[model samples]
Target chain A: MTKPAFIAVDWGTSSFRLWLIGEDGNILAERRSGEGMTTAAQAGFANILQAHLDAISAPLDLPVIVCGMAGARQGWVEAGYIDTPTSLAAILTGAVVVPGQSRDVRILPGLAQRAKDAPDVMRGEETQLLGAIAADAKGEQIVCMPGTHSKWVRVVDGRVTGFSTFMTGELFDVITKHSILSHAVAGAADMPADTTAFEAALKAAFEKPQLVTNLMFTARSGQLLHGTTAAGAQALISGTLIGAEIAGALSSAGQGAAITLVASGRLQTLYEEAFRSLSLPYQTIDADAAVRRGLSAAAEAIWLKNESKS
Target chain B: MTKPAFIAVDWGTSSFRLWLIGEDGNILAERRSGEGMTTAAQAGFANILQAHLDAISAPLDLPVIVCGMAGARQGWVEAGYIDTPTSLAAILTGAVVVPGQSRDVRILPGLAQRAKDAPDVMRGEETQLLGAIAADAKGEQIVCMPGTHSKWVRVVDGRVTGFSTFMTGELFDVITKHSILSHAVAGAADMPADTTAFEAALKAAFEKPQLVTNLMFTARSGQLLHGTTAAGAQALISGTLIGAEIAGALSSAGQGAAITLVASGRLQTLYEEAFRSLSLPYQTIDADAAVRRGLSAAAEAIWLKNESKS
Candidate 1:
């Protein structure tokens, strides 16, 4: 029987996913829930972890490795940050042990760019970056991890030079739900996305990224004047935001730096369409897989390799 | 007592300001209320107007000239729009009279740029432009009316070549109120404005308008990493939005076009500070007086001159 060697968890701001990994480094059992850092702060992170461990009837002494906001200042424990420009491999060794835990539990540190002019911080994405890029990767790489706060990281010779966080997804959610444009996109949730409108807006905003806000207004005015459908309005908003994001992300990038998009599902489709519309080339990496690989690396470095040596 | 020739009303989305104008082109009496288009739509636009009119003990035969959202399709009456590439004076002739009213009531038409690529519409600001710029004025002028939906009009030889509406103010409102940044800027309402942060962010966003969204995230990150205050976070958001707006507004303007800023109170102060910080020369116009002058123009065209001729 292949026994579970360790536990791996990705505990983000609003989501939680765990996997019991065997000695072979494959996922043997899994648990996913809404008990992320936000919820866990109130529900008790240890109790939640124990419940999940008991659900799979894992060994009592099995070690666990966690990443994401669970290590935030307000989360279960403060894992702190590893300042850039640092190697991706540095994060694996920066994992902070969860004190007073029944089992050996560790949470990985985040990445922070403390430049006075362009300060930035990211928790789980640092781990994802570690898994997405090889430790010995050479050349310039522009890695885009799109989500609520989309992160665009500039890496050279496997070192994180800097990164920018675009409030793309969070802005979209607020604008569509709370702004006057809310009226323009009210009934577009169930309808198929208007890709034509999306492509046009994406191209326009990419070329003139400064007019992004004005372009957003067209979602409402276009509906009022040209009778644009709700789906078209929604698509226009999404495309405009994502387009400006891409332009900004690449504004300071090295010429011909390989664009690596780390995303999955709807964001993947949208970003890929945006890049294709703008004729910008990019390679795709599944975000879920990348984060898992990152956690696994930390797990192996912290437990598996140590056990084998012992 | 000066005879009240007509009433000039700026019936906007959330505010109502009416000036009883005498035949001498002076305000005889004034009334202000929160019963704007939104509240008036539910309470009945006619009743709200009548109450204000009755409060002043005005004659039953007094006529009314209204501008703003009251002329919107969802307002008092469907006043329709005068398409762009037309003279500024064209709005005066496009007023639609409300039928079945006790007194004569006219709603001025808004300006609409029907171009497919950059469709836009403005309801009340056309009248403001009418008052802000002379009919026979020559050369190029860039008129910026900063409000909920900031309007930037490009006028060449008194003709509105085109305009764009930047969702700067509304985006700021929604982002600060409903987005994750809300936590960053909490309790900022009473705090004094952080001019230092505002100027820094404004300059940054202006220089790299494409990075507006990314710049916005720095407000939160700055707070977390550098212990920036709530006031600073709020200022950063405001400055970024306004800076991006200014960059986009001037993207296609003629070289050295005169910048005319029509705003009042807080908005006027903020925009003036922004222009000064950017070292952009601009002339100021009082928004309240401009709208009044605009509505008075419509009144003279629609009723006063016609009645005098009769």
Candidate 2:
């Protein structure tokens, strides 16, 4: 018998993506849409999955696996988290065979949080961590994902341990785009990549973080009295946010540790430079591809379960 | 001659408001518009003033005094700030008579900050201090204005002694409205007043100021696990912010002295209660009223200067 195709899904708050992969983990066809968890919550998750299924001509009996927020309380079915110090085997989201669909459907549970200092609640990333673990055949590793809220997870012997979340991206946006520093820059943000300005700002912020407020005055002060360009001010503020993030993250994570950063966006260059400046050994992983690979890994696990049941 | 009608303008970065004052300082007419300094900059100060003049049928020549950001360097003109420990008379923006117009124009200089811990800046509020001081007419006082940024100032001998700014209101808004608190709460925060929730949060924050991050968890956990409503969680966050403000301002300013709060606006009720609970004696000042009077004071200063010059 020809190997049956395995279906995979990686969904988030704003977007939904799906993939059909062969036994060798090769994606035959892929599709994405705006029907994410947020909209799905409004229309019901069952309907969202149907829309995706209608797009594929494959048999409904094919084994399917899902990751991301789809297993959140608001998702199709709550995939209960297995908690920290847990492995993939232990972090199972009980399989739910969607009624009327011949194929088995299993959704990965999200990780819920009640951390001491952080404000965010996450669900899908743990499954991705599971995928990361599955990606590597051996050895302990730490997965660092940078974005609006940066997350770092430690994996030892296939068991997920402690994790930390930082509001680095959001704070950077606020300080440069919304807060008082708006006056210090000549023009609005999204100006362009300014290496010189970025470096100047980073050095100042790292040297004396308190000067942030003081530096804000220079935006208007220079334009008003000393004549500094708005673009220069923008760079200054951006630099400060990045610099402060380095200063803050370094203090917590400490120095001289290897880090594997999962970043695949406009911020790739900036974060790469930041890691280099800190003199830390690190590697960058494609975020989109990782999510896709994670979905496939989850699907593979579901296939094993189905084989066992039969 | 009969006393001339007066105009008091309190213009800032994001808003412009003015009051038409009768000879006796009664508010005959008041108007506010979105054309704050930040937006009105393109029209030039003279054009903005003309727009206000067009709003009123009364003579354009009625003595006009301006305060707040309108007097900053990028403002119509840098009504150079009066140094600390200086009188209103000492820091007057030299009398400028509007050419081709039959009236007097006196710009009140905003206070320039020079704290070792903060950079120097101030505007229209300095004139309000002049009016606030004039209203008090007794001795010394402290003014606390809470918003995205909270300001605490010490007024002595009719001049600002020193002041500091705290990112409380804006920070609170960011955390509750834009940050993680948004998810924990059923909806966005515009948390109504709940005295018990407010007081409990106040007490907790006051007792353990450094546990701010630890305290944030309650915004979500209290609701999911402990039965606190999202609004209640939001209120607790607000309480913590104000509590942090009180703690920060006190420590920054140092204690062992009596304080009279220039209390008004949204801060009046909670701060009054906060002061009472802590046994700090303070008298409330009407903020909106103070601005009108401040405009009048600036006008009065301008008139006196002309008379002395003649």
**DockQ for each of the predicted structures, in order?**
0.92, 0.15
lDDT of 1 at B220: 88
Per-model TM-score, in order, reads 0.98, 0.72
Stretches of candidate 1 off by over 4 Å are: A307-310, B306-310
Task: Give lDDT per model, in order.
Answer: 0.92, 0.63
**Clashes by residue pair, model 2:** A184-A219, A185-A230, A186-A230, A222-A227, B67-B124, B68-B124, B113-B120, B113-B121, B148-B170
Report, to 2 decimal places, the DockQ of model 1: 0.92
Q: Local error of candidate 2 at A201, Å? A: 5.5
A175-205 in candidate 2: lDDT tens per residue?
5556665556535455665667667667765
TM-scores for chain B, in order?
A: 0.97, 0.84
Candidate 1: the clashing residue pairs are none
lDDT of 1 by residue, B105-167 (tens): 899999999999999999999999999998999988999999999999999999999999999
Interface RMSD of each: 0.4, 5.6
Backbone clash pairs in model 1 (N, Cα, C under 3 Å; residues 3+ apart or in different chains), count = 0
